[model samples]
Target: MSPDIVTDPSRAKRLKAATHAAHDRLDKSIMRLEPFSSIDRYALFLAVQHGFHQDVDALYDDPALDGLLPDLKHRRRLDKIAQDLADLGRTAPAAGSKPVLAGDLPTALGWLYVAEGSNLGAAFLLKEAGKLGLSEDCGARHLAGSPEGRGLHWRIFTTALDAVPLTQEEEARVIAGARAAFMRVQFLADAVFIPSPSD
Candidate 1:
């Protein structure tokens, strides 16, 4: 089943923006990966966006169905995601020159996956918080305040996730588990760093 079916369109749109922000951040993270630099940041960004669709597919067990993996294992998919990102960071030059960037498209995407994934995961966390009749403010505050070292924009994005609806304390427990699982996945994805090789 396609993963797009389950992903909220608005969420996907936000993910796209987040992906663009990552590309811009990469421009600063590594000067060599600039949009006009030898590297094609725009193409790389599109590739990373494509990776999101791939993630959605991985998330779904069937059309409109959740992933096959248990909620606790949701982060497990980060392994493949990191790999895909590493591939994205590298792009071939128009003249067929050697790959300009130290890493590939997947690596660039990896950076983005870390940011946007957290926001999405926070959404689930908020849902859980709502279940307990507790305002997601506690968790949302963490995200808003960038408690986990996330950026200001990301913190705000996480707070946005808290707006969703979820009921029942038991459901909140499940969502919390999902949030924890998401953090694990984000950590794994963030750990994949491909340094530039020495000349």
Candidate 2:
């Protein structure tokens, strides 16, 4: 094992490192969607977000995770997404398939990492949403930055994730789960009407 994994193996750090390719897939996928071009596409973006969150919403209730990050439930954004859709005078759009997650704890944390880590990206997305005439109080509530901010919240989650012990094989599962989570989001991005701005 590398000294880093042996001495201070942070799941968060490792997840970020190991899942770079999957993470890039999600990034490239989102960029193909020019959500800022119009309000409709932006709303569709919100629906995509809702769909992804809804599928994995139950993870927060997992007893094993609760023992570690009891406040895991607090990170749910389905209700917020619903509220944003309501603000737009729309309802939840149908999503694609449910995400296939790992049933084990260490593996599940990998999924959670992808889910919770998304808020950090939302800090930037929220700004882009603003350019489309949306705001936290209205159609972009789900994209709004948290009062506590993404950095602090992510730190809390990563700290909890690293605190858990895992075998190297288990760590492999966790990394795979994170990659799967990203792949699921990329799949969701496919069903939408991805648009581009007129240059």
Candidate 3:
């Protein structure tokens, strides 16, 4: 996890602990791809973001979820990612088989947790994008910081996430969903950023 992220003693902390290993693996995999190596490489990275966000796009607007996380609607970044892709002169790849979380709000929250938590690390990513001549208004819109800023934005999100009541079974499913979300990104990263033979 980014040192900037503070996971309090709540469901968010539990998730941070449970998903730590998977999260580390995903980060290492992405770093190995070196998505910041160049503008082209970053475009491939955006494609991966586009694909993963596209999979979870519906969750942002889900009425049930919005009731729990009131700021949910403004958090959707798929369109921003699409804009980034367009700025780079690339189109979104065809969707893959998305994770099946429909009608399963607990599981869906887990997936949403992984997606939203990523923004915490976007501060570093946004700087790297700058090296490639991409800014919030240009090719890196998806990585732009929220007006509330990263730390406060994340705190607000995790606060709401921790407040949602869950049965024991649902809590277990939430952990599983978060892990699955990480694995899904790993799969997409592999597909979108094919490694050279030497890698």
Clash tally for model 3:
0
Cα deviation of 20, candidate 2, in Å: 1.1
Error of 2 at 189 (Å): 0.4
Best by TM-score: 3
With candidate 3 superimposed using the best TM-score fit, by how many Å does residue 144's alpha carbon deviate from the native? Answer: 0.8
The reply for model 3, stretches above 4 Å from the true place, is: 1-9, 195-199
Tens-digit lDDT string for candidate 2 (1-199): 4433532546678889999988987887787788678888877787778888887777887877888884888888889999998888889876567644436776677778888888888878888888978898888887776678778877888888887777777788889888888887787777665434542
Judging by lDDT against the true structure, name the best candidate. Answer: 3
Clash count of each predicted structure: 16, 0, 0
TM-score for every candidate vs. truth?
Answer: 0.23, 0.87, 0.91
Q: Can you write out model 1's per-residue Cα lDDT over 87-194, one digit (the tens) per residue?
A: 445332222112112122222222233435544444444344344332324312222223343355454433433332223332233233333333433332332222
Question: Which window of ten consecutive residues has the lowest lDDT sum in model 1?
Answer: 93-102
Estimate candidate 3's alpha-carbon lDDT, on a 0 to 1 scale. Answer: 0.88
State the local distance difference test value for candidate 1.
0.34
Candidate 1 wrong stretches, greater than 4 Å: 1-33, 36-39, 58-61, 65-165, 168-199
Tens-place lDDT digits, model 3, residues 130-190: 9988899999998988897999999999989987777677888889999989998999899
Q: CA lDDT, every prediction?
A: 0.34, 0.79, 0.88
